[model samples]
Target chain A: MRLVISFIAGLVFSAGLVVSGMANPAKVVNFLDFSGSWDPSLAFVMIGAIAVASIGFRLVGENSKPFSAPRFDLPNRKDIDRPLISGAIFFGVGWGLSGYCPGPALVSLVLSSQAMLSLFPMMLLGMWIAKKTA
Target chain B: METLFTPWHSLFGGILIGSAAVLMLWGCGQILGVSGLLSRLLPPWSSSQDIKVRVAFVAGVIALPLLAMVSGQVSSIPPVNGNPLYLGLAGLVMGYGTVRGNGCTSGHGVCGISRLSQRSIVATLVFMATAAVTVYIARHLLGWI
Candidate 1:
């Protein structure tokens, strides 16, 4: 049951990515290109997502455990440190350069294009390096 | 003021994303953090049980786009612009950064902020500000992307 729900959730999330034009690297690049032909569409996507998620979090707070799981497995870290900032900087630069974040990059894999071929492997390598170092 | 404002699609898409997050939270007791999930799938990171669910979720992500293409709901999958070398480099950096930061846009920006987490708020701001600065440098100054 949990797996089925998660699959459905992932499916819906991908659909949302496509429908919102986020799956398009061009659209994302335009959104980030504030000095150029800026596209504010992605902002609406963020706003709409946050708003609904806020309500969802509230409802989830009332429950001790999730519907199928034993307990909620949410992040609990509260410290502000170098890894946090530096990591964000790296992510930002990458996002600005390629306009593809983790989600979109993974979703784009279905296309099996040359770009994804290069990007995805490097991404995995990056993650592996980070894990090894940490 | 409306040069490229896709208000409806963005909002509807966002709502769908939020709905998915909520479903994940309620149904599976997970946060639906993509980078985290991906990282866990690598080597000896997470348990088999956890990996099973993660695989299922990832399958869903991959399968949906293929389905959309088949049904003609989505015409073309957009490719990354600029040099492929730089694009690949960017992916490498982003992969490391997301893992180091412990979250990405969806995890911190959407799920974290929704829960009013201070860490998430700070992380989101940092990334957004950095992204803006990076864009300024890359697009405006360097003009290499």
Candidate 2:
């Protein structure tokens, strides 16, 4: 049941990504290009997502556990550390350079372009290295 | 302005994303954090149940667009014409950063802020500012992008 719900959620999320033009690298780049031809569409997407989720989080907070699971596995860490800042900086630079975050990058795997081919494998490698080092 | 501002589509899509996050939270008792899901695929980071859920989620993400294409809901996949080397490098760095930082835009920007998490708020700001600065340097100053 939990897996089914997760699958459905993932499907909906991916559809949203496509419909919102987030799967489009050009649109993402334009959104980040504040100095140049700026597109604020993605900002609305973020706002809309956050607003809706905020309500959901509040509602869910009332329950001791979710419908199908034993516990809620939300992040509890609050400290701001070097790893957090440096990691965010690295992630930001990467995002600005490619305009492909994890979700969109995975979604683009079906395209089988040279860029996706190279990017995906390297991304996996990077994750693997991080896992090993950490 | 006309070409860039897609208010309706973005808003609708965002609603869909939020609904998904809600479903994951309410039904599955999990935060809909894509990077965390992907990272769980690695050994030592996931249990059997975690792998199952992650796989299911990834399958859904991969299958939706393909289904849409078959149904003609989507005309075509977008072209990714960036320099392959740079893009690959960016992916590598992003992968590492996401693991180290413990979240991505979806995790920190969406779910984190919605929950009013202090760490997430700070992380989102740092990443957004970094992204803006990086874009300024790469696109405007260096003209590489």
Candidate 3:
């Protein structure tokens, strides 16, 4: 079923995050620190992920619909706008500050991490604010 | 402390993530984006179907990691900025920024670039640059996170 597949996908995705070292905030922050003792591990994560994903997109291009769904929900927006740039900058700053992006932060929840425990609620609040403003 | 660059694990992990994206696309006919999926769980969302996907996906995300930890496969304590206040600030900024930009690392950085979307490429560059600058300021200039 579709639900089973989603769960499996989630499991695989989380495993990747863990194995890639993206789940470690300290490691991520070190990767972001270009001027410092830079760890280029994170770059490989993107490189590896994109390389595989590109093939997936190619396969999808040949198909009209997904296997389990009626239609594919790929983003059609192409324009580079103000909000995009500004939002990205903010996101970047946040990423640099704590090295805890949403995905990894969520994974860290099982650890009962003090930082994520605080970050998660605030993140939801931020999302709520964004929704309200938009 | 000296930080080690782990190419093998990083690359392998990335491949797994990509595989998941591929499966999601092929099986679910949807982009496998963490923040995007998380956003759907919020208010004013579309329908129950959306809820099911998010719930099932997130449950798996959490469940596996939890199992992994029990097996001693996952354990990471943030070396810097363990302070809740600082993390909370970062979280708020990230949450808003990701929504405003319409994606994050998984959504735009990986999936978008994989599809070779111009918007995603630019957004990824901008975020990567800004993140580098932010780290420079916090670590080198300000001497703090």
Candidate 4:
């Protein structure tokens, strides 16, 4: 039962990436350009996700807890300290450079583009370094 | 329609993804985090029970679009190419990120933050920031543009 659900979720998530235009490197890069054609598609994607998640959150909260695990897994910190700022900066920088955030990037993989080819390796390297340092 | 990627459509898409995440989390008590299932491709990292859930999760994700296509909800796919290197790289980054941050954007950004998790907030911020920088360097500074 759970297996069926997971596969469906992944399919929906991946398909969303495709439908939202997040999987398009050109569109993604254009969004980051900010001065070129300035694609705001990613913003739409963000907004769409936030809206759905917000409503879904309320519904879920009202209903029984869904997963076998805890309802919510809260993080441990609250400060707007160095880690927070640095991480944000890093993430922004990466988005600007590669146009491949984690979600869309995975979706892009389904397409197999040159940009993804060049960018994904370094992205992994960055993640690796971060893990090691932490 | 202003094409699909317009603000309205994007917002609608995000809503769908978020709603899916929320529904899955609430109904199944799972986080709807993609990284967990993707990581299951590895033998040591995955458990027997985890495999079942992972399969279902991934299948569901795929099915939604196919169903939509069948029902004519969406007209066309985003696009596709035959570039294995690119696919491999994307996979690698996603896999590594999952390991490093203990979650991906879906895990931390959507699910964790929705739950008011401090760690998820931090992790989500990092994921976004890193992605931003990566784009800047590749397209603007690095001439991959």
Number of the predicted model whose DockQ against the real structure is largest: 3
Which model is ahead, 2 or 4, in terms of lDDT?
2
Q: Pick by TM-score: which candidate is best?
A: 3
Better of 1 and 4 by lDDT: 1
lDDT of 1 by residue, B70-131 (tens): 88766665454545678779989989998888888888888988988888888889888888
Q: Residue-wise lDDT of candidate 2 within B94-138, one digit each (tens)?
A: 888877887888999899999999888888899888888887787
> What would the per-residue lDDT of candidate 1 be over residues A15-111, giving only the tens digit for each residue?
8887887888777877887888789899989999999999998898899999988778888888888888888888888887887888888788875
Position B133, candidate 2: lDDT = 85
* lDDT per residue (tens digit) for residues A26-133 in model 2: 778788888788888999889889989999889988999999888888788889988888888888988877778888887787643456888888887777777787
Q: Local error of candidate 4 at B44, Å?
A: 2.3
Docking class for model 1 is medium
List the candidate 3 regions with Cα displacement exceeding 4 Å. Answer: none
Ranking according to DockQ, highest score first: 3, 2, 1, 4
What tens-digit string does per-residue lDDT give for candidate 3 at A1-134? 77888889999998999889888877888898877889999999999999999997898779888887778878999999998999899889888898877788788887546767889988877777777777
lDDT of 1 at B97: 91
A1-134 per-residue lDDT for model 4 (tens digits): 54555555677677667667775656766765553456777777766776677667777777555555435432455556554455555555444444455666555443543445655565556565555555
Query: Candidate 2, which segments miss by more than 4 Å at Cα?
Result: A111-113, B1-3, B77-81
Q: What is residue B33's positional error in candidate 4, in angstroms?
A: 1.8
Q: Of 1 and 3, which scores higher on DockQ?
A: 3
